[model samples]
Target: MAQSRKKAVKKSFDPQEVLDFLRQDELDYPAGAKKFGKDAIPFLSDLIEGTDENLSMKAAYLVGYIDDESVGDVLKKAAEKGSSTIRIAAAYGAQKRSPEVAEAILSRSLEDNNPSVVKFAMKSVSSMKLGKKLKSKIDHISKNFLDDDIKNSAKDLIKKIK
Candidate 1:
């Protein structure tokens, strides 16, 4: 029967639908785990616009966790355009999924005025741990970190980099 045949067909992929899901999930649980599949990744990618910082940050976080390299550019762009909170989340999230961007994030983290941003940057730098590469970078920017605790933390991190 035509009805039966139609029922057998799968639902069509809709970018808007996935975006709506992301928005709803983000609102419900910003820090909790979310599972947006491949079909939804593009929608999440487009949501990286800085217009809505919270939403953008959530999307970036989800995309980063998805661990898909395709979303790298959008995540990085969100990091650049988003508010400090959003930027920290975006940068931290993106870096976990892609170590290639770690160097750029370290530079931004060093210059960042926000303590939270610097902290996340430090965490990411520690995660990447690229032999001597991080040592020079951390040494050069150690003074920019305003908080002595953070400065000392960065120093401790540099020693562990090797």
Candidate 2:
């Protein structure tokens, strides 16, 4: 008797399907849906570039969880133009996937109009190796940000960097 062999078929990329899969609350980093990083890149990229703010933010965060290095461009773009929530997520993702770009993105985020974005940017910056230029920029933010909370946070980061 001859056995029939089955060929595996690759599924087409579907943003909605990937979004649905990612929407589950139990997904954890280094396991779960994060293991599908390579498969989810295209869908997550579309969502990051989409106009829906909430979905875009969700997608940005998912990019961070995903292990693919190709996520750098999408994360940088989202960090530059996406809403504060998306910027925070993208900054984090970029920090992990593309440290060089993350420095610029996080530095630019320090000037974001939203204090929350600046706060998260400060958090990301703290994880990086602080050099003279970045330390100077952090000093400027600590002295100039309009929000006292952000200023204090920047000041605290400065102390940590020192």
- Please, what is the TM-score per model? 0.70, 0.79
lDDT of 1: 0.63
Model 2, residue pairs in steric clash: none
Best model per TM-score: 2
Name the runs in model 1 displaced over 4 angstroms: 1-35
The CA lDDT of each predicted structure is 0.63, 0.70
How do the residues 1-162 of candidate 2 rate in per-residue lDDT, one tens digit apiece? 122221121244455666676676654645533545567777777887788777777778877766666777677677778678888887666557556767767777766778888777777777765334478777988899899988888788888777
- Alpha carbon lDDT at 131, candidate 1: 27
In Å, residue 130's CA in model 2 sits off its true spot by 3.9
